[model samples]
Target: MKTFDHLSVIGLREWIGLPELGIDRVRAKVDSGAKTSALHASDIVTFYRDGETWVRFKAHTGTRRHPRDVECEARLVSFRRVRSSNGQLQERHVIRTDLVLGDQRWPVDFTLTCRESMRYRVLLGCSAMLDGQLVINPGQRFVQGFPQTDRTLRG
Candidate 1:
């Protein structure tokens, strides 16, 4: 396989974390075609805090089958109308948080929604890929390796 030494080559799926959001291990479907990543959030509620918007939600942080829920709170980035895979438009609460993937780390925005029926709780969309830094191998997984630590050492 051709290599781009500067790029982190990942698989169709990988494990990532959102420690800032209290999600230690979330299986993410790396979907390049998706514009904005999504999080499997339930019981979402909006509230005001220090003149800023905040949201409280429960998300599945572990595997789909052996799921573990994390109660999370984050500053609301915005409220957006997002189109679902089935082409239905829905209003969603968006929040920004740190994404821990393998040896690298970055901040990403996630649209909150109930993804109980989906295979994965998180969807790593192109926006979160951060300027084409990811090269996906369609047949592989954990290309960056499952983060050995619940939270990565990387900043």
Candidate 2:
């Protein structure tokens, strides 16, 4: 995508995957209104490594009966105090990683949180869209096409 030249049109919802983070088929809701992206992560643990903070979390993707477990570890980028759609405030762990959508892979910074209550497992917000690099077609779904399962599993 050309920065400031053209915007990549995407649909309302897309199946995005983070292969490096050991997550595949993360059903994400694309929201241009939201400022930052968030992922549904459980059993979050934080630790220090050589004076830098690192995180370890488990991602359970897919349905309850067909669930898949993926263990992920990433360097902690920041801690963000975010307000939810329902006007609830919480501090969340922020991490930077690459996300694959369609045929493109790009770095995205996202907050780690428990989004189990939400319909989608992930939320792709405006900030991660790179300030107008993406245009959302609210009426459509999977404009970039479905996810290709080419990733090898990691623990």
lDDT of 1 by residue, 58-141 (tens): 987766668788888999999999899989999999999988888677889999988888898899999888654888889998
Give per-residue CA lDDT, model 2, range 42-90, as digits (tens): 8899999999999999876665556666888999999999998888999
Model 1: which ten-residue window has the lowest total lDDT?
146-155
Off by over 4 Å in 2: 1-5, 148-155
lDDT of 2 at 14: 90
**TM-score of every model?**
0.89, 0.86
CA RMSD of all predictions: 2.7, 3.8
